[model samples]
Each structure stands twice: as C-alpha cells, then as structure tokens.
Target: MLGKLFLLSLVCFFSLNFLSTINAETNLIADEIQSLKVTNKDPRMINFSVSLTEDHNYTSARLFYFLPNPSLNKSATRGDLNGIQSKFNNFYVDFDTNKGITGSRFIPTGVTFEYYWEFTDVNKNNYKTEMQQYLFLDGQYEWKLLTADNIFFYYYGNYNKNIQNCFLESVSVVKDGSDLLAIKVSYPINIIYYLSPSDSRYAKPTRSIVMDSMTVLGGVKYTSNVVHSYDQDCGVVKHEVTHILNEIAGHGTLLKLPFWVDEGFATYMMNKSDYYDNIIEKMINKNTVIRLSSMQGKPGTPEKVNLYYAQSYATTKYMIEQYGLEKYRSFFKILKEDFVIDEALQTVYGHDQDSLYLEWRQHKGLPIIKLVKIEQSSIPIPVATITPLNFPSKTTVNQQEVENNFSKQNNSNELAVSNFEIFINNYIFIIVGAILLLIMIKISIFLWKK
Candidate 1:
C-alpha cells in the first residue's frame, strides 16, 4: 500500500510540473514584428503599419522616430500605440508635421523625414524596425530644375535660360553680400522662381501686400514671366533675394531688425541703380528729403513712401561705405541674436539710432535739422505732396553748396558719358569679344573637369 501511494504522489508532481511548463510556453508566445511600411497620407503626415505573424499578442507598442532632414534629431520621436488602432494584423501611427509629431513647428516641404517603429509584446520582447525616410510635398504642381553648380533654381512653366541666369547671377552677389556681412551659409543655396504673379502659392498675399516679389525659405517668387532685364529686376529680384539672404544669415529670424535696416540692407546688397535716386536727388535739392530717423517701420503714404525707401537706402549705404562692413557685420549678428536695433547700434557703433541717423545724414551732406520723435507705429503721413522744410529755398542755394553739388554731379556725368562712349564705339567688337571669351572660359573649365 505504501509503494502505491508513493507512485501516485510522483505522478501528481509530474503532472503539476508539466502544466506549469505549458503555461510558461503559452506566455512566451509573443508577437514579432515581421515588417514595417510607411506612407504619406498628406503633406504633413506619415501613415505607417507593422506586420506581425505567429502569436499576435502585443499588449503594448509604440513608434520612435525623427526627421533625418539632412540629419537625424538628437532625440528620437516616439508615439504610443496604446489607443491607436491596428488593421489587417498591422499596427500604425501617423507622424504628423502639423500636429508637431515630427518635432515642433510644421516640417517644411522638400525636406526628408526619417522614422522607425518600436513595439513591445506581452512577453517583454521589444521589437524595433529599421529607420525609414519620406519627403513631404503637396504633389499638386509641376516643376522645373535649373542648376548652376550647387545653386538649385526651381521654376514653373517654360524654361528661360535668361531668367534662370539672372537668378544665378544674383546668387553670386548674394554670397558676396553674405561674405561682406560676415555671415555663413552651410546648406546648399536653393531658390525657386515663379514665372507669373498668379503662379505662386502666396499670390494672393503677395498682391495684397503690394509687393512685386517675395521669397520664403530661400525661394524667390516673382510675378510675370520674363528673363529679368538688367535694370528692371533689381526692385523685385535682388531686393527679395537680399531679404532672403538676410533671413538666412540670421537663421530665419529678422524680428529684431529695424524697418529701415531690413529694407535698406536689401537695397545695399542689390547695389543696383536706385529706383528713386532721381526723385531723392530732387527732394534733397528741394530740401524735402525725409529725416532718416523718421524711417521707422514701413510708412505707406504715397508721397513719403519713396522718401522712406531713399533714406533707408542712403542710411544703409552710409553704413556700408563709411562705417565699414566689419562693424556692420557685428551689428548684423547682434540684431540676429534678437537685440533691439538701438542696443545693437550702440553696441556696435557706440551710438543710438538717432546718432547714427545724424552721422548718416552728415555723410550724405544734408543740412542739420531737428527731427521729431515719432512713435514707430504712428508715423505721420505726408499730405498729397512733400513740402520743403527748414532749408534755404532754391533761390537761397548758397554758391558754395551749389558749386560742390554741381562739381560732384558734373564729374559723375562726365565719367558715365566717357564709359558709354567707349562702349558704343566698340559695340560690335565688344560683343564678339565677350562671346569668344565666355566660350574660351567654358572650354577651359570643361577640359579642367575632364
């Protein structure tokens, strides 16, 4: 009887052990992520899925990702799939740009986003898929590509080499300006050309703002279709591009730049023939030029608008020529770092805006006049015509000042005439020579590359 009882106990113990082993094996049967597929549902979102085979007991799972937008983020982006749905035996998540899932603000187009999925099973097995990449775009418009080395110029509509070349030419000037300002650009220079005013995505806003052109994210958007003529495109093309470069050098922040500094800096970079130079000269002769200090914000009165732009340009030119670019660059960086214009000026030039204005005016040979301190947002509009103020009238133009102005203008006119005469005299030969020179240079470059 005792032996039989012992055998029964052994059988019971073995049965219990076997049951425990089966329970452990059942618990070990957790889901393994077989595959991951990512897709863009919209310009801003990434829809993804994970395939699981065998045991599908994933009690908890999530995705870890980041935009390798030229580079990966220092921290990985993660999303919990606890409440997210799974379909067709696959789990998914949408890393949204608008929703700040792909880091903070909206992820700009033409940038690649990278991500990966991380999932956990009931058995504590954490599965991670490989990183994936995606480019965000609206996919609604056709595009063209124009390249000059590293500069990428994208345009819509028919290809015009002249228009593209204008942009390429502007690119060199822009870089030169950046160098002058002691600014740096690490990324590739990317620009977009909008052939027509209505063709741009920001067309309505562009029109509403009364601007001939605008730029965003280093892309130049202009109105109407034409290869920019030399003198004509300065107001639109180089002006907008200068603004873009300033934004770029400052890392896309121009909040601290004063209204004149911003606009004037653009004009300075272009350094083309001024649109209002004649008008400005006339105003100066009439002693009607607006005080440089009055150019706060973008004043909109028709009469003073050109005057404001002129002062801005003159002030900027003064800074560039008289103050030296090194000091201007330091000031540019200070403003870029978000210091107020007055503080930046004081730090860099040892003076405030008023003092700078006074100096700039003196440099331009304008008579000293007391200027009212107008609130930035409350700039008084000049009525119908700009009235001359606080100066000797044309009849009172002292002989010395007139002689000085006349001598300067006469010398400039003579120099311009002499250069033009030479050009006209050798016109046909000059063109032929230029063409041959360009061809030779191109051949040399081709051979060097080979």
Candidate 2:
C-alpha cells in the first residue's frame, strides 16, 4: 500500500510539471523585413513603405521616426502603416506635408530623420526592424551635394556660374565664420538652394510670422540650422550662415540675441554691397531712422524695413570696429550666460543699449538725440490680512481640572487592581481546601485497604 501511494504521488508531480512547462512555452518566429523605401513626392508629401518576404497577417503595424537635431524632441513620432492589401501587399503610409503629421509646420527641408518599423503578430509578439535614416528633400529637383568641413550644400539643377561661385565662397565664409566665433561645428549645417526662383513655389513652404505690424517672410533663418535660399550671391550664404554660427556659439537656454544685434551682425558679415551703408545715412538725414533699441523687430513699411536693416548693420559695424572683436566676443559670452541684452552690453562695453545707439549715431555723423528714460513709478499695493471665522480652537483645560482627571483615573485603576488581587486570593484559598480534602480521602482509602 505504501509503494502504491508513493507511485501515485510521483505520477501527479510529473503531470503537473509538464502542464506548467506547456503553459510557459512561447512560439518564436522571425519575420523577414526587406525592400524598405522612402519616396519624396514633393516638399508637400512623402511616401514610406516596406515589404515582407512571406505574406503574414500582422495585428498592428507602425512607423516610428524623429529628427535628431533642431528643437524637435528626441522621442519618436509614431505613424501607422496602411494595411497589407495597400500597395500590392507592402506595408505602406503616405506622409502629407501640408496636412496631418508634417503639416505646414516649421519642419525644415533637407533635415534627416531616423526611422524604424514595428509589427505585432497574431500571438502579440512584437518585431522591430533595424533603424534607418532618410533626408527630406525637394522632390521637384535632382539634388547634388557639395560638402566642405561641416557644411552640407544641397544644390539642384544645372550648375550655373553663379551657383559655382556661391558654393565655393560659401565654403570659405563658413570656415571663416566658424573660426571668428571660435565655435566648433559639431553638427552639419544644411543649405538647400533652389537654383531657379520659380522653384521656390515647389520648395518647402516658408512659414510667415507677423512682427511689428508686418507679415515678415523671405528670411532664411525661419528654421534653425537650415537655410533655404534662392539667391545666387555668396553674400546670401554668408549672411544666413552667420546666423547659424551665432546660434551654435552663443545660444544657451536663451535662444537668441536682440533682433538688431542678430540681424545687423549678419548684414555686416555678409559684406554684400555698399547699398546698406548709404541707406542709413539717408535715413539719418531725413530723421526717419528708427532707434536701435526700438528696432527690436522688422518694421512695417518697406522704407522702414530698409532703414531697419541698414541701421542694424551700421550699429553692429560700429560695435565690432570701435570696440574690437575681442570685446564683441566677450559680449556674446555674456549673452550666452543668459544675461539680458542691455546688461550684457553694460558688462562688456560699459554702456547700455541707448548709449550704444547714441555712440553709433555720433560715429556715423548722424544726429545723436538724447533718449528720455521712462522711469516707472512704483505703486504700493494694499494687502488684506484675512482671519477666518467660526473655526473651533483647540480645547484647553485648567491645571486643577487636569489634576482632578488624573486623580479619578488613578482611583479607577486602583479599584481594578484591588478586585483582581481579591479574586486571586479566593481562588488560592479554594484550591488549598480541595487539596486538603483529596489528601484526607486518599488517607481513608489507604486505611481501608490496610
């Protein structure tokens, strides 16, 4: 019987173990991912697709992607892939640039995005493809790359003499700017040049922002670290690249310098033409040139726009030429430390914005008008101390009351202790009497037996 019971126990153990193993087992299968492709329909749309070696139904399919640079977060942006029936059994999705995900957003053309695809099978097992990178480009033109140092120039259409000159000069401008600012170009600055002016319509749409009562467009600095240009001049490249270098060097948690300092420095570095030099002088004579402090944005009228740019150029030129590049470098460093523009100027040049403006005007042979400082009157605000009503206060007892309560608790405890002692004494007395009775009965039984 013992042997049969032991055998029965062994059989139950084996059966239970086998069932647990089956429950824990999983089916592992690898899907063959092949022919991954990204097709640019235009700047307005993109198509992404991938093919499978064996046609197997997946419960879910998705594409995950993100731009590594720019302000776009590093976290992946998810895009769902169309069903297997679409595009002849290929997993497919069309990304509309003007609608849905990409939209008319500030996502710059020519920037690269890293992407990968994920698929979940019927059993809920997930499979992910290896990561890949694709550059978003203008599909309207065949692009040719011209790379120098850390600058990547993407130009399209037949190379004209202007294009050649701009490309070569851009290389020199980028190198010189990087050296002058003492900033290492860790990431590539992509310059996408639409050779024909008509091609601008097909290129990525530049978003417009209203500034200073004017809709400002046509600026290449719309996207960070990327330039979309139609100009054939090397000055355009220099001007735009100076903005990029400035951002790379001095931008900290504070994203930008003042508009005048930023735009003026770019114009001065461009060395484009003598046109800006005379525009400011004419505006000064007409007493129409806006103050540098007030020209914090691009102005409304065309004439004011011209004056704004020229004044910025003139002021920045005065700063660098008068105080020297080292002082300007120090000023940039102070700005990087998140100092306000006026404070940075004061720290570096021992002057404020208005003072710099007057100094620049005096140097330009323009009238130096003393700006009236607006002192804001400090108004004392009346503060009300609100005391809440109807709330119960903590209950307080007198010293005599506390003593009386303590005495009562002591009396109760003494009564309980005395009752417990009396019960214990009675129990002992009863137990001793029973023992004596049992001893006498045992003696009587012994005597009778004897």
Best candidate (score: TM-score): 2
lDDT of candidate 2 over 1-450, digit per residue (tens) = 565555555555555544543343232233566588889867766788877665556666666554454532232122233334354336876765533222233345676767777766666555667778999888777889988877788887787787777777777777887766676677677888776445755453432222211321232643445676654556666677777777666664634566677677777777754767777667778877667668644444333456667778888888888989889888888877767677788899999888888787777677557798634222322211110000011221000000001001121121212334434642664555555555655555555555
Please report, in order, the local distance difference test score of every candidate based on alpha carbons. Answer: 0.48, 0.59
Residues 176-227, candidate 1: write the lDDT tens digits: 7767777654444444455543343421111112222211111222111111
The number of the candidate with the highest lDDT is 2
- State TM-scores per candidate: 0.52, 0.70
Q: Which residue segments of model 1 deviate by more than 4 Å?
A: 1-86, 89-108, 111-133, 142-144, 147-150, 156-158, 202-237, 247-255, 282-308, 333-340, 346-350, 362-367, 372-450
Candidate 2 residue spans exceeding 4 A from truth: 1-31, 70-89, 99-103, 206-219, 300-303, 374-450
| Shift in Å, residue 71, candidate 1 | 13
- lDDT at position 430, candidate 1: 46
Clashing pairs in 2: none
The 10 consecutive residues of candidate 2 with the worst lDDT sum are 397-406
Candidate 2, residue 56: Cα displacement in angstroms equals: 4.2
The deviation in Å at residue 360 for candidate 1 is 3.4
